[model samples]
Target: MSNAASAQTTKTPGPGTYRASCHCGALRIEADFDPSAGTTRCNCTICTKTGWWGTIVRPGAFRLVSGEEVLGGFSRTGAGYSHFCKTCGIRVYGHGDIPELGGEFYSINLNCLDGVDLTGVPVDYLDGLHDTWEQLAAAPHVDPVTAAKRLSQTS
Candidate 1:
């Protein structure tokens, strides 16, 4: 496991496996645990349209259980990759490397998570529209690396 994975093991939903998927289950990822805190909402053009709500996780802690062939994705230069279920058109997850974050990270969509009710999870709203990293970094509900990524976005 990676440092991020080791870090994840110490966090919430404590050391257990949790499952998530797209609308039709055509895409699935098994996470070590559910994020019960510091998740976020992005207001960028793409995120705004898809309503993609997520929490950051290390690559080792997120396992793609299935549906690799049925998944589609979109990405832009200097931006993280957004993946979805090709059949149902449900945006499932996203990931990318953040140099400031130390390495690769997965953005797991909370809406795709099964058996997890994240209603009360404290959410940090990010200003992705204008690339507001300074403001995002100041938000109490998210990690510094995520705030860094928001700053790195290309328009």
Candidate 2:
């Protein structure tokens, strides 16, 4: 088995296999990830703007089941590419090469996964804006909806 397969050995109690898609259903993927292990939220310009909530897996653990022809990619830093659906513009996943992460890694957007409830999933916060990949962010990230509510209350 590949390292990606081994890494998916179910460290947490959650669905191991997930079906993911873009908003328009033009891009689809099958991913093997243990969500209970945690999802990631990065505070980088791209991630913040895209509202990315991702789970990382090696290439073997991620499969583009369909709609490859409709997938569009964008890369701001050139380290990796964020993929979205050409029709609906919903980012489904991303892939990049990060030496610290054992080379190539795939970032599956947890938001795109079908039938997965993330209500209580542990969120790993990355301070990507500061390039502190090794350190967690001082403040946990709030989703856009929550942030907006907070903004309104303080105003």
Candidate 3:
């Protein structure tokens, strides 16, 4: 193949790598994803309490850079484990395999990202509390997708 074509094919993709760390900087992780694609906010009990703004990425795309010893995990939903920094008690990300979401995935907490600004990024709310993971939740307290569909049908 031509030299120019070879270089073009070998060049790495640009501008999406992000560095994230816990509050005390004990744990760190790196991932590559478009910030403009927005994040997901689930209305599940644990998510509501912990304030997780998640960016879903495949397992291969997420990397744990350091602090393996200090990392702790909690499995509230049984679907995945929410990993946190034991020192700072901050949830940095989660790992799980859900068939509905297309197998193994990592949900990175956007709040832990080092320098990325999420000013205008859209937040997709999910009614995980009601197990309606298929459609977006209208609001935190609003009805689940099925309930909303029923309401629409009656109306």
* Residue 103 local lDDT, model 1: 76
Lowest summed lDDT over 10 consecutive residues: which window, candidate 2? Answer: 2-11
lDDT-best of 1 and 3:
3
Tell me the whole-model lDDT of each prediction, alpha carbons only. 0.71, 0.77, 0.76
For residues 34-143, write the lDDT of model 3, one tens digit per residue: 65666688888888898788888888789999889999998977989999999999999999999988999998997777754455456678788898865574322222
- Residues 1-155 of candidate 1 have per-residue lDDT tens digits of 33223222222343366677787776888776556546788778878888788888888888998899998988864658988999999988898998876679888887777655443456777787878743353243344564677679954
- C-alpha RMSD (angstroms) for model 3: 12.7
The TM-score that candidate 3 achieves is 0.75
Which ranges in model 1 have alpha carbons more than 4 Å from their true place? 1-15, 134-155
Which rank order by lDDT, best down to worst? 2, 3, 1
The TM-scores, one per candidate, come to: 0.73, 0.76, 0.75
- Which of 1 and 2 is the better model by lDDT? 2
- Among all windows of 10 consecutive residues in model 3, the one with the lowest summed lDDT is 3-12
For model 2, the local distance difference test gives: 0.77
Clashing pairs in 2: none
Model 1, CA-based lDDT: 0.71
